[model samples]
Target: MPSLLAVCAVHALRPDSGSVGVTAIDKRPLDGEVRVGPLGVRADVQASRKHHGGPDKAVYAYAQQDAEYWERELGRELAPGWFGENLRVEGIDVNAARIGEVWRIGEKVLLEVTMPRTPCATFARWVGGAAARGWVKRFSEEGRLGAYLRVRRAGEVRAGDAVEIVSSPLDAPTVLEVYRS
Candidate 1:
């Protein structure tokens, strides 16, 4: 019953820090269907491939519920893709999603939950400067890190598409548990 609230991607950018970056972390909602390939959403780029973007971590999804919680805590409006998620979804417990879970988006694109997103220094830098360290600490302590997914079937995905869980392995750990460990 969960649905895709947004699909987002971003182009490369050069930060003021004089470093070459492709931190597509600042994504914006796409208006129409976007291709979902084995690498990830079409045109989405990762600044640091050493830590992100691979066959096992192609796509990232965040639950709207968790965003709402952060909005309240940060006392600021958190929009879709605010946390650099490729997919903003609703009506699903992303924190409870286990590894090996398969999600069929719309009628085509299929994705499998692979792991939880671990907070990184790049993320902290993207969020804030001096306070970034504390932000990462708080975020880790919250244990609400979103899920990373790998594409199982390539197809087009769009906002409002239904997300159906086709399978979830019983032996796998939930996203929160993975974050804690």
Candidate 2:
């Protein structure tokens, strides 16, 4: 079985306060069973619906200086940075997933790679990294970044849910491949 990444849920900024909208009605957890729609969930609070804004709409994983990378790059113990991915999956590299591929979550949920996640100005402050702006630019060049997907089918998803790639488009582009070209 092949896997494609999907954000089970996300925390959005409240319209007024600087606080995160974690428990809003539109953001509440579903009861572990639902159907995927064309535009995804019509409601604002569900996981799939939130990603309508592209990358900013969902996650922001980063590959900064980590203990693993540092050991290879500089040979020292380094703190790893977490990208706030809803599912911290290992084994499969989400960044390398190709576009127009259909990723199924658990059993019911499905996502289609519609585009690459383009970093926005909001990320500069979101990350607080001094070189975040430059980092995003370099990531674009390396083509090792993830993508933005639209919900082809919406359903309840959990953190440890297994994602599977059900379809791969022919001559399609990976997120980075699309970005680079």
Candidate 3:
């Protein structure tokens, strides 16, 4: 069964985040349950409304498998939420999730896969150091960052929650298809 590994949200801001100036990309995993709404995890800050945060981009999720891949490539261990993902999951291919596919997280909160996260200059700067060099280009080529989701039903969420796929639309594009296009 697919499970939510962690629930991450902005704990602070980085001032020199390239184009964005300030960013909430450096999120930290939270303890206990958290309330989630149409806008996303309550109190999670999105520095740029134009680039992020809204009904469609309410929650961002990255698969632990993908993060592990990066861990090996970057030759470093990564903490939960390091990728700015509200939810880190395992046993599900988030990149292959189809657009409009709905998921029931835990006993509540129905969310729909909306799109894939687009890497920006802010993300590159947030990475910093040798990894930051051509980071965006390499990330784009990899194209398995994560998926953005819209809340279909507001509810509470926490780590260790079961993630159930409730619906998948054959007509819709997969998250990876949308990302690479």
Q: What local distance difference test score does each model get?
A: 0.87, 0.47, 0.92
- Indicate whether candidate 1 or candidate 2 has the larger TM-score: 1
lDDT of 2 at 149: 61
What's the true lDDT of residue 23 in model 1? 59
Per residue, candidate 2 scores C-alpha lDDT tens digits across 1-181 of 3332233333453232223323221132233433445543323343224434442333222223211442453344322222333333334555666777777777787777666656433333344445555655654565545555667766765534676778887788776677777
Candidate 3: stretches off by over 4 Å? none
Tell me each candidate's TM-score.
0.93, 0.59, 0.97
lDDT of 3 at 124: 85
Off by over 4 Å in 1: 11-22, 129-133
Scored by TM-score, the top model is 3
Clash number for every model?
0, 5, 0
Query: By lDDT, who's the top model here?
Result: 3
Ten contiguous residues minimizing lDDT sum, candidate 2: 21-30
TM-score of 2: 0.59
Per-residue error at 129 for model 3, in Å? 0.7
